[model samples]
Target: MSDRKPINDAMDHMNGIEGYPTNVDLKSLPKPLRYFGYFFISFFVLFFITFFVLSMIL
Candidate 1:
């Protein structure tokens, strides 16, 4: 289609733009709390997976 050319040209122009920031400020929780959060989520996921598999098997 004739309309495709303008759209393609616009996309090509956007590809050359510099979008990354030179500096960033990062914040995070304490190490112990972060580890606890990770463990909690992992255990929750494993528990549900085990439950579903057992239900299907029985």
Candidate 2:
């Protein structure tokens, strides 16, 4: 019968987490550079995990 979803309740639950940094200024960067940073960090994490696994296996 209600049209509005319970999004506020879910967000309130997330906000209660310990040590969670709530104030992120994503708009400070250009759109392209933001995506580039995401891609670079993702690649770095993946490469580190793969190298660690391979080293353990060999």
Candidate topping lDDT: 2
Q: State the displacement of the C-alpha of residue 42, model 2, in Å, after optimal TM-score superposition.
A: 0.6
Cα-based lDDT at residue 54, candidate 1: 100
**What local lDDT score does residue 23 receive in model 1, on the 0 to 100 scale?**
43
RMSD of each: 10.1, 8.2
The local distance difference test score of each candidate is 0.68, 0.76
Candidate 2 overall lDDT versus native: 0.76
* Candidate 2 local lDDT, 1-58, one digit each (tens): 2233446976656655532544569878898999999999999999999999999999
Off by over 4 Å in 2: 1-26
Q: Candidate 1: lDDT of 52? A: 98
**Model 1 TM-score (2 dp):** 0.53
lDDT of 1 by residue, 1-58 (tens): 1223325866746644633333444336678877888899999999999999999999
Clashing residue pairs, backbone N/CA/C < 3 A, model 2: none
